[model samples]
Target: MRVRHSTNLTRNGLTDWIVQRVSAVILAAYTLFIMAFFMCSVDVTYASWTGLFSNLWVKVFTLLTVFSIVAHAWIGMWTVFTDYVKSTAVRAFLQIGLFVILFFYFFTAVLAVWAV
Candidate 1:
């Protein structure tokens, strides 16, 4: 007999696995890029920091990094919640709370990166 697995979030095991890996790569690349940028800069001034993010490409990359972070967190948290939290009510509450917090963070990053 084949065991069927289902999730309310529409992501299957394969999709979730792929998403997690892709997001991880993006996160790693973004971190390295940021570190390199900081390392190469001689003067770490507020103006220089702001100037780096003022570029269109940098803003877009930052948004993508924010998205990758949220996606990675969601998948990891979802797996943990499903695996360890046995109570339906408790799991649902935690999942909802996690989503709310993640969404808020994503939106905040967007506003911060794009605001002139």
Candidate 2:
């Protein structure tokens, strides 16, 4: 016997899929900029680091980077949780845990950058 599957995809799922791809592209561009900045700062010093962070453009870029990372990780984690976890309770718990960890790191990075 042969089985057939539905061809239609859920709207939310498709939205999430599109968002993930867009986020990936944004992340790629951001990563390249960060890599270039680091490479150019080979002779790094406290003053040099502070100077980079002190710029308004750099601060805005950092905020965008953090937002993109959080968004990408959230979507990726949600996909993993949905695919692998069979129980609803388990999936919810895992997602909550992931959010907590992500938020903590996000805030920490924000504070560190702001302090610079």
Structure candidate 1, residue pairs in collision: none
Provide backbone clash counts, one per model: 0, 0
lDDT of 2 by residue, 35-112 (tens): 887898878787887887899888877877787788778878777766677677787788789889989988988887
The count of backbone overlaps in candidate 2 is: 0
Which ten-residue region of model 1 has the weakest summed lDDT?
1-10
Instruction: List residue ranges in candidate 2 displaced over 4 A.
Output: 1-11
Question: All candidates' TM-scores?
Answer: 0.91, 0.79
State the weakest 10-residue window (summed lDDT) of model 2: 1-10
Instruction: Report every candidate's CA lDDT.
Output: 0.85, 0.74
Off by over 4 Å in 1: 1-10
